[model samples]
Target: MDVLIIDDDPTSVFLAKLLLSSTGLFDKLTTYQNPVDALSFIKVQLVDNQLPQVILLDINMPLIDGWQLLDALMPYQAQIQAKYWK
Candidate 1:
């Protein structure tokens, strides 16, 4: 399974990687320090049907929070397309 980590804290991301990596449960692990970049990645992945099986999102972020990210992706609940936002 694939996993995504979207947190602004480098320490948190590091610790999360340490813990999750130790378990050796995921096939692909990706991390992003910026919410916008993470969102864009998710959008591309969603379009390609490669969305991560799990996403470790930070509730508190600078530009966009976890809830906002989820809100943006909500469009996928029906039918997703790259044009949804662009």
Candidate 2:
């Protein structure tokens, strides 16, 4: 499994990684402090059919909060959800 974590706080990222790492559920774990960068990464991944199985987005970022990020992802929702259903 693969997991992606998006957060502006380094400490939160570290803790999330540490806890998730201990579970040994994912072979690949990716993190991005900047939601903008994360969105770009996700867009590329979506095109490449490499979207993460799980996304851990922080809902309380400075510039772009998780809710807004989700709104951005709305266009890709169909494709993104299809991965899980299959």
Q: Which candidate should be chosen as best, given lDDT against the real structure?
A: 2
Q: Model-by-model lDDT, in order?
A: 0.90, 0.94
Q: Give the TM-score of candidate 1.
A: 0.88
Residue-wise C-alpha lDDT for candidate 1, range 10-85, written one tens digit per residue? 9999999999999999999999999999999998987788888788999999999989988988878655435343
Q: Output the number of the TM-score-best candidate.
A: 2
Candidate 2 regions off by >4 Å?
none
Checking candidate 1 for backbone clashes, the offending pairs are: none
Give the alpha carbon lDDT tens digit for every residue of 1-86 in model 2: 88999999999999999999899999999999999999999999999999888999999998899999999989998998787676
Q: Number of clashing pairs, model 2?
A: 0
lDDT of 2: 0.94
Summed backbone clashes in each candidate are: 0, 0
